[model samples]
Target: EPEVTQTPSHQVTQMGQEVILRCVPISNHLYFYWYRQILGQKVEFLVSFYNNEISEKSEIFDDQFSVERPDGSNFTLKIRSTKLEDSAMYFCASSYRMGGELFFGEGSRLTVL
Candidate 1:
């Protein structure tokens, strides 16, 4: 089965610093997304990308947050300024079509101090 892949499984950053999280979705998938789960909290959607543009985004995706598929394969999330509340496990996911079951990557854990 095809799966999403993420790099730098763990990251530690200071407050106000920038961090970039990376992911590679399944080869044939067209829709990609980013989600994050804070410790002891439910997972929350951040953004969804399709057709090289943002299809959906949550309130949590503020000016400090951004996503891109720079090389058309690797999907990336960049946090312009990390905050203590930004600490969470970030998951990348992909789907063959809209509203379909998503294939997720092993999460990237971010710890902000």
Candidate 2:
């Protein structure tokens, strides 16, 4: 089965630094999503993209954050200015159906120091 892939399985960055988390979603999937978990907290939706535009986004996707499909297969989330609160396990997910059965990547762990 095709799977979503993320880079820098673990990342440690200073509180004010910029970071870009990368993911390559399944080639045949039509919807892509980003979700994050803060240690023990519930997973939160960050954004969803389809047809080359953002379909939905949560409040957590603030002005300091941006997402893009840099290429046909690569999707990325850029945090221009990171905060301690930004430390979380960022997961990239994809689904063929839209009712929300998301298949997630192993996740990129971001640690803000």
Candidate 3:
């Protein structure tokens, strides 16, 4: 079965540095989302995208965060500037429709120092 895939399985960066996480959702899925878990915290929703436009975003998804579907097969999340508090396991997920079952990637771990 098809599943979400993320690149740079783990990344270590200095504070204030830029970081980009990439993902490829299930081929036929329609909705895409970026979610993060800060260590032991609950999974926090960052943003959702569909039809190449942002559908919704959380307050945690400040100006520093951005999501894009640069091509038909690729979805990405970029952090303009990394902060110590931004360290977490970023998960890329997708579903056939909003609020449907989500297929999640193994996750890209980001560590800000």
Candidate 4:
């Protein structure tokens, strides 16, 4: 079965640097999203994109973050400047139908010093 793939399962960086989390969502799926889980917090949605525009976004998605589909199969999340609190597991997900069950990649663990 086709599955989503995330790069660099673990990442470590200083308090104010850029980081790019990558993913390859299942083919044939359209909707894509990015979410994060603080060390002991619940997974929270950052943003959802479809047809090249943002469909939904949580309060957490601010100026420091951006998402892109640079190619047909790759989706990426870029953090312009990371902070200590930005240390978390970033997950990429995609679904064929809106509001349907979302399939998530294993996740990329980002640790900002």
Tens-place lDDT per residue, model 1, 1-113, is 67899988999999999999999999889999999999999999999999999999999999999999999899999999999999999999999987788999999999999
**Cα-based RMSD of the predictions, in order?**
0.8, 1.2, 0.9, 0.8
| 66: Cα error in model 4, Å | 0.2
Stretches off by above 4 angstroms in model 2 are: none
Q: What tens digits encode model 4's per-residue C-alpha lDDT throughout 61-95? A: 99999999988889999999999999999999999
- What would the per-residue lDDT of candidate 2 be over residues 1-113, giving only the tens digit for each residue? 78889998999999999999999988888799999999999999999999889999999998988989988889899999999999999999988768857889999999999
The residue pairs found clashing in candidate 4 are none
TM-score of each: 0.97, 0.94, 0.96, 0.96
Quick one: how many clashes does candidate 2 have? 0
Report lDDT (Cα) of residue 103, candidate 1: 95
Query: Model 3: clashing residue pairs?
Result: none
Which clashing pairs does model 1 show? none
User: lDDT of each structure?
Assistant: 0.96, 0.92, 0.95, 0.94
Off by over 4 Å in 4: none
For residues 1-113, write the lDDT of model 3, one tens digit per residue.
88899998999999999999999999999999999999989999999999999999999999999999998899999999999999999999999886799999999999999
Q: What's model 2's TM-score?
A: 0.94
Summed over model 1, clashes come to 0
